[model samples]
Target: MTDLIAELDPTQWYRDGRGPRYKQLHRHIRGLVSSGDLAAEDQLPSEREIADRAQISRVTVRKAIAELVADGLIEQRHGAGSFVRASSNRFEQSLSSLVSFTENLQARGITSASRVLLKGLFRPTPTEAMVLGLSPHHQVARINRLRSGDGVPMALEYSSLPEDVLPRPDKIDLSLYELLRARGTAPTRAIQRVIAVNATAPVADLLDLAEGAAVLQIERTAYLASGRPIEFTSGIYRSDIYDFVSELRLD
Candidate 1:
């Protein structure tokens, strides 16, 4: 704490013409975390200690700490002071490609795994039936999974496939696309809609995030080469760790 206090001297961090004082403090502390000067899980000095060393008011210090917490750079524990959070791995997924979550992680050299929360053949819901072009009387294979990369929970996925496309839900262990391809039912294209949403209680629990955390909701309907809709899937992903990118081109 002493070393940290000395390093945060006002002369070095607090400066004129650098926007707000609180923001300056916030950037300095963020730099420390990024540079590994303040490693993950390292305890931060008390607000009073930092304020005293930086020659700033406690209010200023508190505001800076609040910004850090909101940025996911630090976390405050009740009665335990602030701590640098462990850096999370950020993954960029290309919107131009049609790929599975498992494939995306594997391409990045991350070990992908899933915890199957639910899987069975069931009557298709209205949305599922409409999206997959299934009749109300037809059944669908529903698979729900908590997806992880290198053991970090990253997404909660729910997928419904026409029974003809996925006859055996129990046979699915890893990639659903792999099974579909083996059965000659792989989707050649998809229409996806992405939206920002706050995590609900169940989604937060599955993704190991606090309730109301920002998340990306993706709803997709995938089609076979013959233009038949085969899969309808919805997923909630951690916004802090995922970036969806697209390359735009002019005609």
Candidate 2:
């Protein structure tokens, strides 16, 4: 802890243009945690120690530490000062790419697996028929899966495809895109909408999150090269561990 205090050089705590003193300190500590300079479970110096080392008011130190705790980057224990929070398996996915969950995880060297919850060929529901351009008599192949990365439950997915596009739903043990590509019907593009939702009891159980925890609900329609819709998928993702990033540029 003494060494940790020494590393928080007082001179580095304030910058000419950086907003406030508290925010500056917050960013500094967050950087240290992100860079692994401060490992999980490592104790942070007491507020007085930090104040003395940085030559700042204890109020400033307290405000900075409070913000860190709110960010889920640290925790305060009763009678035990504060500590860096244990790292969770957080993942960032790019919105610019059209990729399957399996492919996304594989690119990061994370093992991906899916547990099939439901799979069958059935008459299309009204919404499914409208979305897939299927007639009432047409059948849709449906698959529901619990997707995991390195054995940690990540997302719950339910996908509906034209029956002809996915005749053997049982054959999909991993990447749906891989199977579609092999059949020469892989989606070339997609329209996706993401929204925040509270976890239901069933969703909470599957993702191992508390009931009412915030999660991301994604609805996607994937199209083949010829502009035909091939798949309609709805997924529930644990927001605590998943981040979707999109780059913006001024035209």
In lDDT terms, how accurate is model 1? 0.84
TM-score of 2: 0.68
Please report, in order, the local distance difference test score of every candidate based on alpha carbons: 0.84, 0.85
lDDT of 2 by residue, 120-237 (tens): 9999999999999999989999999999988877899999999999999988889999999999999999988999998776786677554455789999999998999999999998
Candidate 1 segments whose C-alpha is farther than 4 A from its true place: 1-88
Q: How close to the true structure is residue 44 of candidate 2, measured as C-alpha lDDT?
A: 96
Q: What is the lDDT of residue 181 in candidate 2?
A: 95
- Candidate 1 lDDT at 61 equals 94
- RMSD in Å for model 1: 11.3
lDDT assessment of candidate 2: 0.85
